[model samples]
Target: MINQLSWKVGGQQGEGIESTGEIFSIALNRLGYYLYGYRHFSSRIKGGHTNNKIRVSTTQTLSVSDDLDILVAFDQETIDVNYKELHDKGIIIADAKFNPQRPEDTNAKLYAVPFTDIATELGTSLMKNMVAVGASCAVLNLDIEVFKDVVQEIFGRKGEQVVQKNMDAIKAGYDYMKEELGDQVGAMQLEKGDGKKRLFMIGNDAIALGALAGGCRFMAAYPITPASEIMEYLIKKLPTVGGTVIQTEDEIAACTMAIGANYGGIRAMTASAGPGLSLKMEAIGLAGITETPVVIVDTQRGGPSTGLPTKQEQSDLMAMIYGTHGEIPKIVMAPSTVEEAFYDAAEAFNLAEEYQCPVILLTDLQLSLGKQTVEPLDYSKVEIRRGKLVTEDLPATDSYFKRYEVTEDGISPRVIPGMKGGIHHVTGVEHDETGKPSESAANRIAQMDKRMRKIKNVRFKTPVHKNVKHEQADLLIVGFNSTRGVIEEAMTRLEQDGIKVNHAHVRLIHPFPTNEMLPLIQSAKKVVVVENNATGQLANIMKMNVGHIDKIKSILKYDGNPFLPHEIHSQCKELF
Candidate 1:
């Protein structure tokens, strides 16, 4: 019995390839199988190669496998580009119309089927994806009732006749596969689990839900790839909760609008990728100087300047942490899992409000766009904490309130706009206690210290070190963001091979967590920083925080793909 397997579908853009993978994954998830899915596509909309890969396992998996166990190819180009990634005994289901041939070097088997022809005969060519799904289910010996139920839910709104026709197409595909291939196709049967339900979502959806759960009432954004889905999701769901979403003219407008909404006493956020973040930098600096608490999500993509818009990278580490002009104490939080992405979003608002400073949530395309089977988040545990909010009645005064008042912890009680005794200056320029422009040297030093001091006072309890191995590890691996899963998996495999390796994953990037990280790195015999950027951005940040920069080795990947666990293991093997 197969405990795990990987299935993939490849075809031209807009051909329902994604839908096919989704249907298969949902059915597998219903049977309590863990899933990790990824998609590869181009910048163009149509007539280009696109594929969806889903890995199913009885055990929890968050990273993609290096080889495919089954591949469904819609065209000859699909086989040409993908056959090398298939395992030795892998099976390829190709469309008979394409007449696909296996590569000369591979030992995998290829079976041709009339996927499109059968669907067209059933009244709609769109059912072709369902046909592929049905054939795959037959091959895996999966109960067809689950697939039929999912189809009914998805297509029931269209009409009864449409749903019936699709069901006929599924039967045709399944019968064809069974009759032609016989017992050979049913050789690999996946073992079923305890059938406990789990939530399946991408990181963006989790963040959007977390925002709603955290009481975020406003969002403004200019649409951009990868990051646009966060805004799009909020647009549909926010109105139901009495929240508002606006598509601003540009990223600058988005950032400023979110800041303005926050000034009016609401939790507001804006999201964008690398290019949009660059446009929002000046506005972010304004939020910093004015001490407006707002959350900005940077769903990072490959870039020097729109470098690879749809690709994944952890390259924004330096840009997110140090990109803004002038000195500002901003918090940067990176969530490693889809579930963590939700909690991180909720915590981001709390941190921003507590310190009255902007918080940047740094996420990569892999974590932002990739789908995973995550456990349901406990909403009761989600604490809504708005720090330093003064709700008591303060009598109106002619002199404006002390908005930026320097106190013991450098955090002054904050009042919203139009509130009594709360009308104060809101500007990009540095201001004094009464919220007026000031050039006094003492005033400048005191204000700077006050704003800077709030970083440590953040209510967010950040872990300085995690995933540390006991019994004196042989090496230490340090990474952030999407690399967490693969790095942790690699550490496990290395341990099995008698290598004692520990890992330190930093959730809070800004204050750098110097005290907790310094001793860990100092004690390790060897240290490696794995990130997606070409230059070792995380390593440099570690150097700046701790003095032993030279001791840290850097393993980086910038080719717009995430690191596979085996790749991490192979790279670490060379180090030994």
Candidate 2:
């Protein structure tokens, strides 16, 4: 029996390809198998090729498998597009309608089942996805009953008859496949899992949940690809806690509205992808100068303009760091995993309030949208620390409340509007301690220095996550965001091949974490920064901050796809 296997479902964009893969993976996840899933689709709403590839393992895995074991297809285009990723022993289950053809170049097996015919006979043709899921179950020798929970949850509201029809489709497909393959049906059975409970969700789900737990009472955002889910999730759950979400007319309105909420004493946030982030930059700079605490999530997608909206790319690294005109202090954080996304998203509010500036939570398209099995998040770990926020009534003085006072640590006492004796000017222009606009050079210098110095003692858990196997290593693989898993998998393979490899994933991006990363770079004979950008932005950031430019190299991919383990491993091997 195999310990792990890769399964994929492909079809037209609006054809329920995603639902089929979701049902299959969720049932397996219920059995406690660790799963990682990635989706490839077009930017439009429908009519393009789309697919969901899932890697299921007895042990935990981070990235998509390098090769596919089974391909479930609705049409020949699915096979024509994705056949090359299959191994020689791979299997393809397709609908008999298309009379699918297997290319002569590959030895992978093909089975044409009557998916549409069976689903139509059961009541609706839409249940073809359920039929496909059952055929997959037969090939893996998995019990069809494992899908009961998911099926009930999805179709139970439609009434008992609808639910039974879907179940019948699955049973019919499974029995048909089992009868044809006979004993061979169990050939690809996966090893049994530990049967532990876990959460199967995407990074956006984690971020939204974390935001709610962190006391974020208001979210104002315009919907955008990848980032829209954060807003969508909050729309449903925020009201349970007396919070709310606003889908503003534009990104500018979203950012400004969130700023207005924070100014009124609520923990407010906004989220968007690259294009929206671009539109929100001026407003972000406004938050910086006004010293308003706001958390913004930048889900990085492929971009310059609207380039590859549904693809993966980290080209926003430099923009996030220095996007706004004329420097004002800001914090940018990158969370490499879904768990970190949750925790970091929660902590972002604290950081924004403590530092009295805008905090950006950064994520690539892959990490933002990829679905995976996650351990139960501990709500006890989420702590809300609104720094220097003066909740108590201020003294009954007539003077402005020294809102932007230049203290030793640069963080001044903060109070919301209408607080007793808390009246002060607020604007984007240069301002003095009382927040009034000022043209004096001395006052300008002081306020600017204070804003910049607030981050000098930034509070963060870990700036860089290190998986070090050697004190001194032949190679150091450095990355940020979603590259963490793929790098870990590559590190394991390289270590087994006798290459001393270490990993450093930057969790905090703005402050650069030079002190933590410098030693690792110095110890290794060579350093390669792997990022999903054309120009190797992360490498340049390291070189500029940590130095050792000669030893630093970059492995870059901007092809709108995430790096696979084999791709990373082979590239690092070549460095030897």
Candidate 3:
């Protein structure tokens, strides 16, 4: 049996829920435990309940699940709100003074630890989270040394005085646990591995690093939840790399400025969430018509209009696909893992330039904010594709240069300003072989077809659909973006249970990998589509192209929480 433990620390927004979770995570990671954490909170500074769930395993973990093994209640309301999620054999640790009227029939082991009271005795209530941490370690029989190392790592930079106080608080809580409940505690063992092999990073940082590697010289964005970290990370790092990062006035300005940077012969990127993406739609269309190579990273959040700004959602799939007006040929792709985010960002820039169109990298809030241990990307392995821009001297044109000069591949040779006789006019209106405003229906059709053809061509050049064990299984599971890791992990578990399962995760969403996907679906006995979005956009796309709608089953979630492997496995079992 897989040993899984989830700890929920809930309290008012400012009561150090995140700090406690981080401290636990640091300790667990140092102790060689594989962990996955998910956090939920309101968009308030104080008084609203916030909950952070951490899933820890002795083995590698890819997703966060629903069942809780331990609930560390900071207040009565926290226990009230999330008590039902605890497993029957689980434990609930709460403050003795604030015990709620829990159900008498419930089988969960309850321990009333006076966490706040202990913190008061330690001279400050600030260490209540620390108290919770110590109590949890005591119950789990986790190493006290691990907690000591975590405390020093987190608070040692402050000063000796603060560090000493926190350490004392930790020891006090540990002692309290030993005095109150002695040998009920049992230790969980973790497998040893080479520490240097792992690289820790959050999704936003990985995306920024990818963009930098892809020769992104200019970035413009307005701060928005989930996507804000990308801007913040790039802003500090961009200047060091001789690049420019601007915090624009709004999302509209951000997109437009990024387009302008692209026009000035630099690879440019802008990032935002659903609401901000709406603001950039008009400018996105303008980029499309002008054939400007700009990358827009829409780290999607829930919405039609500002719905759940700080929450996770894949609802923007349709919005990103058809948000722009008119026939705009743009590439849309999503990365599944932190490593994929890095590589996808670089590939996004390449596609934007090669197609001479805007590309939206559709990442969601889950992947954006989620932290994981990933392998450090090798910069030497990155191939920087700088599009068709020529730096060499061109033969002098008798008249003005034709920027939209159509070729066999529908891609025109592009030249930057200050290049000899390469300057040309770019407009949103229909243009001929020469770049100028034209009202002719024929020119419009040709331009539209040319733009669409570029997307078609990209299908051949881009990465193919990746499958883990496609050949050996009767059932196949398909997913995209952040769902990739969870689905893969689920497939592994199913295989272990004697269910022959295969999996495919797509990195290229648009121009959906027809050649690679059609054959796989045809061979599989059952095809299941898994996604984080409620409407099953990926499922719909597969039905539209692959022609086996009846065989494809969808397991979708849109509750502002990600799909856990256990959840997916349970769903797949139902289908089986």
Q: Number of the top candidate by lDDT?
A: 2
Worst 10 residues of 1 by lDDT: 456-465
| C-alpha lDDT of all candidate models, in order | 0.87, 0.93, 0.80
Model 3 stretches with alpha carbons more than 4 Å out: 1-4, 100-102, 147-153, 187-197, 459-465, 468-474, 496-498
Best by TM-score: 2
Local lDDT at 207 for model 3: 94
Model 1 stretches with alpha carbons more than 4 Å out: 462-465
* lDDT (tens digit, per residue) of candidate 2 on 4-69: 999999999999998998899999999999999999999989989999999999998888988999
TM for every model, in the order presented, reads: 0.98, 0.99, 0.92
Using lDDT as the measure, name the better of candidate 1 and candidate 2: 2
Error of 3 at 380 (Å): 2.3
Worst 10 residues of 2 by lDDT: 179-188
441-529: candidate 1 lDDT, tens digit per residue: 99999999998888974545655448876646678899888888889889998888888898998888887888778878877878899
Off by over 4 Å in 2: none
